[model samples]
Target: MKTLKIGLLGLGNVGTGTYEILAMNAAKISALTGCEIVISKVLVSNINKKRSLNLPADLLTENAADILSDPEIDIVVELIGGIHPAFDYMLTALQNKKHVVTANKAVIATLGDELMSAAAASNVLLKYEASVAGGIPILNALSTALAGNEFDEIVGIINGTTNYILTQMTDFGLNYDDVLKDAQAKGFAEADPSSDVEGEDVAYKLSILIQTAFGLKIPPLSIPREGITKVSKDDIAYASQFGYKIKLLATAKKNGSTLECHVQPALIPVSHPLASVSNEFNALFIKGNAVDDLMFYGKGAGSMPTGSAIVGDIIDIARKLDCLPCCLTPQISAPTKLIFAGEGKSMYYINFLVADVPGVLGKVSTIFGDHGISIESVMQRSKGKSEGEDVPVIYILHESSRQQLDPALAEISSYPFIKEVRSILRVEPLN
Candidate 1:
């Protein structure tokens, strides 16, 4: 069998896991692919830094040119987690006619079109199966298995860090800050977890998903996103009382000639599949015209899970080394006809503090009626309200757009009986 040498970039947790997987599953991988896959060189910042993996002294190098410019390397695997040098290195490798595989979602979401065009120009395949949900082959399924079907909607709990934090808050009644600290301590979150907690990470993944499923390239920043920072124990308790769970959901839907997409903290029914996906696990619910509804669930993030995705992409490219480069023209195309509608109508959960008076709900109802908004349900507990103290009131509003609801909320906020609007979350209809 011929040999396919690999040049690996970065040596972090996922990088180490990739090396170990190749080493442990060498014989099986070779037997399956009919190629002896090997990591010929690794790029690191400090070549002298000791690693837990028993790598050869000759294999480590501080220079990236040794891999990017080499004629012998068949593939360049980029494990670096940023857009700066990783994007440049991948572009250079593709320009050099070397096949490239990466797990960097930021680069892919931001500059995927340019890279795909580069791969097509150079007759090389640019594979990034590990970019979105780690270890879940959702991209492969979308590009190949489900390619025939028209996807109507894609809803997923893609970020494991935020999901873990929200799960802890729902299960144990813990606050967001306390659960976030726990997540960081347990290695589920980064020290500066603004990316994960602020919903930017999910936006990146959603952008990739939009391309794969809808054949549309929407900028990640353009997707309206709301983080889990405002989610509190009180909100979690209220959701339970209403037979729902609060989860940060990445959602995209197709509506005739327009597409709607957003990432926000929403309330899903207790019986929904995404509601049971707790802790660090992930789940995606897809609606296809032919396949009906399909849900993919598994470990979304971890060293080995992400590494498994990387190795899978490497093997895929290795098997096609002798064949012509597969065209990604359809994969990276922008939506020409479909209009990008920001966010569509949905049911809402509105919580606010108000004076425990008889006519407060009536006045609020009048405001909502003036704005053509209807209430689905309302809940108020008498146990927490003292004779003169303010009490919390929850309202589950009927389907209404943000444009219609915002004015009513603004009008209600000016009332003297209103103390504060505690939470405003969307309620997703999963059925």
Candidate 2:
């Protein structure tokens, strides 16, 4: 049997899991690929760091150069979750003609085009099936299985931390802050949860998904991002009443040559497939001209789940070693005219705390009418005044563009009787 020596970078949760899975499942993996995959070397920050995996002493090292310079290592699997050394290490590995498999979405989203070019030139395989949705194989599905169809759009609840927080808020009536603390306590969120909570994590993942699904490459920062940090208990209650569940949705659609991408908290109808995905699990909704709409759901993040994806890539690469092509051909070019977020149109759920008086609704309705924004539905609830103040009112808009709605909001905000606008969330349709 052909033997494939592997070098691993980092020995954290994911790295240790990859090592354990490969070791425990060696016989099955060998049978599947007809190759013995061995972890020949590991690069870690501290060789003295207590690793959960009891790897051979010779295989562990503190120096990354030891692994990268070794010509015997056939494939390098990078599980280091960061931008700095991970980016430099992957680039160097590709330059050295070593095939690479990684689960770092931030690195892939930011430097994927350049890395793909490097791998292509070096005739080495660069696989990142675990970057977007953990264990779902969404990347392979988009690049291979669904390649025959013209994809209309991709809507995903791709970030697990945000999803977990949203699920808590919706299911248990907890606010964003409370759910976030719980997520951190449960190890679902990091100490510095800004990346996950502020939607940067989803934005990074969406960048890769957009590229794989539609051959689009847009900077993560370019996508408009709004996190669930501002989603209050009141918003969750109001959304539930409207037959909607609030989710952090990452969306990408082709607008002529422009591919529109954004990550934000959206109001999805409860019956939609994405709305029902609760907790740390994730679901992706893909709309294609031929396939119509399809959903892929699974664990979004974890040691074993991510390790499974990495192993799958390793097995596939080993099987295809000398038979077909060494590297995948670039399937699609970057779309030239990708649409910006503010240019897209959608229905909105606007909750305004307006005056309870009779003419107050009429004035607000006239302003919306003048702006050509329609109200699909309206709900007004009275919170008994603690200090004898005006009651609050909520309005849900039917459909409108930012161009039309922004002016309307500004006009409404300036009204004398309006106490406060509690929240405004975009409503994503099921069909």
Candidate 3:
């Protein structure tokens, strides 16, 4: 069997896992791919830093050119998690006619099209199976297995940190701050987790999904995203009372000629498959014309899981080494001409505080009616305060667009009887 050499780019958690897996499963991988896969060099910030894996000092390097410019290295696997030097290194690798595999979602979501085109020009492949949901193989499935079908919707809990926090809050009735601190202590969240908690990570993953599933190039920032920071214990309790669970959802739907997408805290029905996916696990629900509905669930962000995905991509490229360059090139279909709309109509959970008065509910309903909003359910709880004091009121509003709902909410909030608009969350209806 021939030998396939790999130049690995980072020695972080994912890089360590990748090296260990390749070493432990060398015989099996070689047997399956008919090639002896080897890590020729590993790039790290510090050559003397201690790692979990023991390796020869010669295999480690502080310089990237040792790998990127090496003619013996057939594949450049990038595990660096950033946009600057990582993107530049990957681009240079592609320019050198080497196949590039990356686990950096930020780079893929932002610069994938350029890299794909470069790979096509250089007669190499650019694979990013680990970019979205780690170890899920959802991207490969979308690009190859389910390629024949047209996807209608793709929704997922793509960020493990936020999902873990939300899961803890919902299951234990803990406050957001408490669960977030616990998650950080458990290493499930970063010290500065704004990217994950603010929904930017999910938005990045969702943008990649849009490209793979719909063949469109939508910028991650363009997708309207609301994070889980606003979700509170009261919101979780209210969701349970209504037979739902609160989750940070990344959603994209094909609606006629428009694509509706957003990342936000949504209330999923308890019966839905995604609701049960809790604590560091991730799940993606895909709706296709031919396959109907498909759900993929697994560990979203562990070192080994992510390493498995990266190695899987490497194996695929190794197996197709002799294939024609044109045939091996990725078919990122032409950008579809779909209009992008921000968070389209859906059932909404609206919670607010209103004065404890008889006519307040009627007046709010009147405002909703005038704005084309309908009430599906209503819950009023007395706080045992004196007369004319504000009390909590929750409403499950029927299908209404934000354009209408915002105006209605603005009008309602201006009234002296209205105390606050506590929360507004989307209710994802079952298909």
- Summarize candidate 3's per-residue lDDT along 1-431 as a digit string, tens digits: 89999999998988888898898899989998999999999999998887888788799999999999999999999998899899999999999999999999999999888898899889898999999999899998998899989899999999999989998998888999999988889899999999999999999999999988987778999999999999989989988999999999999999999899999999999999999999999999999999999999999888899999999999999999977776678667636778788789999999998888788888899999999999988888785667767788999999999999999999999998899999999999966
> Poorest 10 consecutive residues of model 1 by lDDT?
327-336
For model 3, name the residue pairs that clash. none
Count clashing residue pairs per candidate. Answer: 0, 4, 0
Error of 2 at 94 (Å): 0.5
lDDT of 2 by residue, 1-431 (tens): 88999999987877877888898899999999999999898988888877677767787888889878889998999998899899899989998989899999999899888888988888888899989899899988887788778787999999899899888888888878888888899999999999998999998998888777777677887888898888888888888898989999999876676666778898999999898899999999999888888999999889988888999889978877877563444334434445544337788888777665778888888999999998888777765565435665667787788889999989988988888877778888858
RMSD values, in order shown: 1.4, 1.8, 1.3
Q: Model-by-model lDDT, in order?
A: 0.91, 0.85, 0.91
Ranking of candidates on lDDT, top first: 3, 1, 2
Off by over 4 Å in 2: 255-257, 324-343
lDDT for residue 369 in candidate 3, whole number 0-100: 94
Higher-TM-score candidate among 2 and 3?
3
Q: Where does model 1 exceed 4 Å of error?
A: 325-336
